[model samples]
Target: MASLFAFLRVISLLKAVWTAYSAFYLFRNYLAARKIGLPIRIIPISHTNPFWMLVDRHFISFIRQLPFGHNSFTRYNYRGWELADRYFSHHELGDAFIVVTPGRNWLYIANPDTIVEVFRRRTDFPRCLELTEILNVFGPNMSTVDGLQWKKQRKMTATCFNEQNNEIVWSETLGLANDMINYWSSKALLKTVAHDTRTLSLHVLSKAGFGKSFKFEGHDERKESSPSTSYKDSLQTILENCVLIMALGTKFLENPWLPQGLRRLNEACNAFQKYMTDLYEEEKQAFAEGRTSGRNLMSSLVRASQDEAKTGVGLTENEIYGNMFVFNFAGHDTTAHTFTFALYFLAANPQAQDWIYEELCQVLGDRQPDEWNYGVEFPRLKRCLSIMLETVRLYTPVPVAKWTDTRTQSLNVGAKTVVLPPDTMVIPSYASVQTDPKYWGSETLTWSPSRWIKTSNSTTANLEDEELITPQHGTFIGWSEGSRDCPGRKFSQVEFVGTMAVLFRDWKVDPVTQSGETIETARERVLRLIKSDSAPVLLLQMLHPERAPLVWKRR
Candidate 1:
């Protein structure tokens, strides 16, 4: 009885000590932040905690709904930047503001010049390697590695995204878009546009990355519930179940006693590995015989690996597979989500569609999609490019995440010198900066695709020829900025442009109207639905795109 009472006393004493220590720790950080003269918001929990993240996220959201709280507090997720704009719309956060949470400090930057400085000084402000560790599930790939390993991976993969690969993307995308358009046209009312776009992206990535092709169809369209282990089935399964793979890992799923879903995942991963291994062997044999064409990304990576093998700097088998998976993951979903957003934007605004169709008519003339060469035809379709650029600007698929140097770093925020602590996360809010009126005029919040294009003659009905405006440095970072920017920028551009030309050239799309809603009202409702319903999934996408069915008609 005495020992039990003593143990209870110890537990109570420990809890009291912990509470005091936590309070003192937070108070110390508060004083430190005050000394630096920066705006500070102290939260009790770490943003990374799943439960606390959910709670605080909802707390901020709740605050945002209360009176002017909507204009005061930033929400905690991807759309957090919406309220971030309200907070820093006038540069109230100046170059950066400090967000102090338990055991972590986040410095969110809204200033373009400071963002450029952060990007330029890579050594001073390197990538948050810890944040990307999830991407290293298979092995150390380009997205997750840093320093020498990342350099080697990047050099090997860089050659794969050249002009030749882009040409392949352009041609393949045209074919896929044509097939997808046919599929959509067959639908009584086109729902599942998001799923359809994802299918199209996966097909394009397959052909462009691995030189594999497939007919466009719904994800669940296979007649057999359990298809044989083929490249299409295996790759699709892997892509769709990435979160599961990330959580449970390849090893965990190997257990014989696991659930059917996990067993399926294991089978899919094994099948994908087999497919990749065969591809690697084929490429190796071709390289040995000096017959390598380097047509697709995989072939290019394989060629690079062979060349590096002589110098003892080649990617290992695991590294190669990791990179290939990363490429598929990074390339597939992001571009697909971008496509969905751009499509919705175009459908909502018929004027934008008209502009795109006009440019397509002028650029392609009477030439069919097959005849439309990447080199000749792609350069002429600037409006299509503008639509993509505009969409990406507003709905950036991936936000930039960097951290302060190991040593304290000084930043010039307006006229003040702010010293950021070592290892503090530095997020350049792309949504806030890209939409800021200082760089993008007063109508920055509006989805006006024309903002990206400059007309030669404002009054001329011939809007066929217009120059795409290049935003000032650091102001436009949809594909990100500096050395670590996305390598597949051109790949995505080629695919997006090709898909747009193919789909919108001969047809018009509008939201399906309900009982008494006119086309214009439906369009307005769609615009609202996208604004309200769109949130980040794997990427920023229409949360429930099926809620708004689109109708297609020949123009």
Candidate 2:
């Protein structure tokens, strides 16, 4: 009894000490934040703190139930806070503000001009490498590195996203989308829309990135194929359990005593690594033999790096593997989530579906799907592209993070020059800036694809001649802005447009109505689901998309 009391006393004392230290630390950060001359909001915990992130939802929920907890700092200091807060915080604290926490001062900027200045000054505001270091598990790819290393990787990777590769993306997407539509149409009501889209995206990436193609298998039709089928399975497993893999790591998960699921993840990691290694050797051998007919991303990347090696600047084998993984990571989930969102949005809004269909009919006419050339037809699919753009504007998959590392920096925010202290995280307020009415106009929150289209005044002008509305410099950063922007921007665009062209050209989708529910009610339910259920896991995506099934039919 005495020992138990003594242990309890020690625990209490430790908690008191930690609480005092945290208070002092937060106070110090508050002083530093005030020096920046921006509105300062104090938060108890930093969003990036690994411990807090694990239990944030539950803790925040508990906090909200307490008196004065709804407006507490815990609310804003959680992952995906931007989605919940939106432009409200900016509205309260002007275009730029400092979120002061014990760990660091986070400067969130919503101003367009200020954002442009930040993007332009890359050296002054490099990416937060510490945050991205988790991505280095494979190796230091472009997403995980900065400076000259990033330049080398960027140059090599950029070559892979050329017109030829985009043509492949377009062609593969059309085929996969047709298959997906057939699968969906066959079902009475499709619940696995999100899962199916993700599968389609993964298959597309597999083909476009590695010159390996797989048949689009629906939910019911899914089964292990040939010996190489593990390649797809492994990649899918890695992506699905990416957070766990990143958190615990492959070595830790590979332990024999861990759970069966974790063991499978470990197996997937080993399998994927081996697959990449095999592909790397093959590509290197092919390059050595001077047989460079392969137009896939892997061939282009390997060849480009090899060509650069003659000048003593080439990606290492591990770097190639790292980049391949990053490409798969970036290309697959982002597009898949965007597709799911657009599909849900379109399902709810039939008029928008009709709008895309009308453009498709006018652009393609009686041309068969095979005859739809990338160079000729892709440019004319303005409405299809708009759907992608509009979807991303509302829910940007990967919100980029930049920081002033170990050096104090000055940034121009409107007329004021703000001095950011060293170790300040500079996050572009993507949700706020993209949806701000000042730039996107009044229906900023509304997912209206037509907002991006501007019809030409010339009476003789063809539908293909319609131009896309260019938003203010920093307002629309779906693919990001400046040099470090997504290199696969056009790749994603091509894939999305092709999918849209196929899915909406001759078909329409509707939300599966519940018993005694009207079509309008069903539409509203889907809209509510989209608004409420969507959140960032690896990226912003619909959480329980299967909860809201969809139905497809010929228009």
Candidate 3:
């Protein structure tokens, strides 16, 4: 009895000491932050804490209703830009502010000039690898490294996203768009737009990205070609259960006694590994025999690595596989979700669809899908490109995350130089800056794709001749800005333009509505559904897109 009491006393003392230490650490950071002269938000728990994620939804809702509430709550899940704007209306937080959470300080910057400076000075403000470490589940890829390692991964990866690969993407996208149109046309009300878009993106990535192609099919269509697991099935499984795969790891799936879901995940991991290994061996053998065609990005990467390996500077087999998976992860959902948003936007705004159709007609002039030359026809599809840009502006898929170097950093913002302490996270709020009224004008919040189209110099010209407006540097970072900007920008653009041209040319889409509801009312409801349904999963996506069914009609 005496020993038990003594041990309990020791435990109590340890808890008290730990609490005091945490309090002192937080107090010191708070004082340092106040000296920096930036707007501050003090939260008890770090935003990244998994435990806090459970209550985040309720916390955000409660905070928004508070009198004169600041944008501190914007750190929670989706619609961060909208939250930022509301807070901006209520406070004078300038272009940037400090979010002091627990023991860390997060510096959120929305200023265009400051964002440009941050992107340029990569050495002073490198990415926080800790956040991106989840991507290294396969192996060390481009997104999870910095300095010489990142440069090495980037050098070979950038070469794969070239003109030839883009041409393949354009062709594959056109083909898949036709297949998707056919599938949608057969249905009275299409509820699988998101799934269909995901499949389309996966197919494009497979062919143009990995030298593998599959026929486009509907969500209900199931025709397995592989003996064990289809490549598409494996890839889709990986994408769907990415967080689980990252947490438990690919090897965790090996235990047969585990839960059914986890066992399936294990099967997926094994299937995908076998697929990658087979492709790697084939490519390597082709290279060894000097018979390399280097048709797709994967083939190109393999060829490049082989040539570099001779000089002892090339990527390893595991590195190649890791990067291929990264390409799929990065390329697949970003394009897929963007396409989903574009479909909904078009369904709501028929006028925008009409504008794109007019542009397509003018550019192609009744040319068959196969006849449309990527080099010649793709350059003229500015309207399609504009719609994509506008969507990205409103809904950035991947927000940029950078951190201050070990040394302290300072930046000039609105006649004041703000000092940042060491290891502070510097996140460029793409959503906030892209939609800021100061940069984008009064209708910044509105979804008007026409804003991206510049009038032609010739007064007699029609819409087709208008040029695409290039937003000021740092103002529009849809594909991000600077040396680390997404290398697949043009690849995404080409795919988007092709899909838009094919879909809008011969078909029109409108939201399914009740008999009593008017078209304008239906449009408003669809827009609301989109805003509400969109939540940040791995990327921003329509969580319950089926709530708004779309009907397709021949134009």
Candidate 4:
């Protein structure tokens, strides 16, 4: 009884100490934030704190139930807060503000000019490697490095995403989309639109990224390729359980006492690592033998690294594996989520489907899917490309984070130039600026692809030319901006356009209306689903996409 009482006393004392320390730390950060000369908001816990992230929504829910708990600080003290808050916070606190917390001060900027300056001065504002360290779970790759190491990886990555690779992405995406459409058409009402699109995306990545190809399998049709594991199964499992893998890490999940699902994820991690190793070995052998027929991303990357290795400036074997995983991770989920969003938006707005179909007809004419050329027809499908752009405008998957590491940086925000302290995180307000009415017009929130199209009279007035409208530098950072923009920007665009062309050219998707529900009501439901049911797991995506099944019909 004495020992129990002593233990309880220790716990209470420790809790008190922690509370006091947190208060002091937050106060210090607040003082620093004030000196930055920006509007400041305070939150008790940092959004990046892993333990807090795990319980953020639940804790906030409990807090809101208490008196004086429902406030901006509680609301915004979570990861992916930008998705919910949007321009409202920026409106309240001007174009720039600091969110001060015990962990760090986050400087959120919505000003386009300031954002452009930050992006251009990469050294002044470098990537927040601490936040992105999870991406190095496999090994140090392009996404998780900086300085000279980043330069080397960037060069090699650039080579892999060349025109030849984009062509592969285009062809492979078309084939996968065609197969997926056939599978979708067979169903009366498809609840697995998100799942199917992810499958299509994974297959495309497999073909283009690693020279591996898999047939598109519907939700019901899928079977494990092997009793133990298959490449597709491993990759799919890893991607699906990304948050779990990232949060708990592979080492912890691999423990034998873990739950069955997590153990399976551990198996997947091992299987994927093995698959990458085997591919790396094959590519190395191919290079040694001078048999350079492979043109996939993995092949290109391996060849480039080999040539550079002779000069002591190439990616190591683990680095190659790491990059392959990162590319697959980046290319797969980002496009798949965008595809799901675009599909739902199209289903809700049938006119948008027709808009893309019109462009497809204009570009492809009498040519079959096989005859469509990437270099020629892809550029002509402006409406299709616009759909991708507009979808991302509304729902950016990966909002990037930059920081001033160990250096005081000066940034011009509106009329004032402010000095930021070292270790300050500078996040571009993607959600706010992308949808700001000042730049995107009054209907900024509406998912209208036509907004991106501008028609002009040519020299002969009879002929009209249409082109995509270029938004202000920082307004539409769908693929980001400046020096360190997404290297696979064109790769994703090619895949999206190819899928849109194939899917909409001959078919249109409509929300599967519930019993006694009007088509208008069904469309509204889908729109609501898109707005409310979306959040970031690893990236922002529709959470319960299956709740709103869709039907594809021949137009």
Local accuracy of candidate 4 as per-residue lDDT tens digits, 199-292? 8889989889888888888878987553136888898888877777877887897799988778788888999999888888999999999897
lDDT by residue (1-555, candidate 2, tens digit) is 999999999999998998888889899999998777899888888787878888887788788888888774755878888987878889888999988888888899999999998898999999898887777657779988899999999989988999988889989988898898988899889985888888999999999988889899997888753323589889988887788877787778868999877877888888889888888888899889888657888788889999999997899988988888889888988998999999999999999999889999998887767879999999989999999999999999999989999898989999899888889999999999998888888988888999998877667557766899998899988888899999999999999999999888888999988999999999999999899888777689988988888999987
lDDT order, best first, reads 2, 4, 3, 1
Q: All candidates' TM-scores?
A: 0.91, 0.96, 0.92, 0.95
Number of the predicted model whose TM-score against the real structure is largest: 2
Single out the weakest 10-residue window by summed lDDT for candidate 3. Answer: 78-87
The pairs that clash in candidate 4 are none
* Deviating ranges (above 4 Å) for candidate 1: 1-25, 54-90, 224-228, 456-465
Q: Residue pairs in steric clash, candidate 3? A: none
Model 3 lDDT per residue over 1-555, tens place: 999999999999997986787677768778888988887877655667665565666677777777855454544332343333532521366688887765578787877888999999988898888888888767888888899888888888889999999999999999999999999989999874998888889899989877778899898785654324688888887876887887787766687899977887788888888888888898989999999565898899888888877886888788888888888888988998999988898899999999888898889888889999999999889999999999998887887789886889987665778888887889887767787777787888778999999877687578656999888888888787888999899989999999998898999999988789988888899888877667666677777888888999998
Angstrom error at residue 155, model 2: 1.3
The deviation in Å at residue 129 for candidate 1 is 1.3
Task: List ranges where model 4 is wrong by over 4 Å.
Answer: 1-10, 61-69, 225-229, 257-259, 458-464
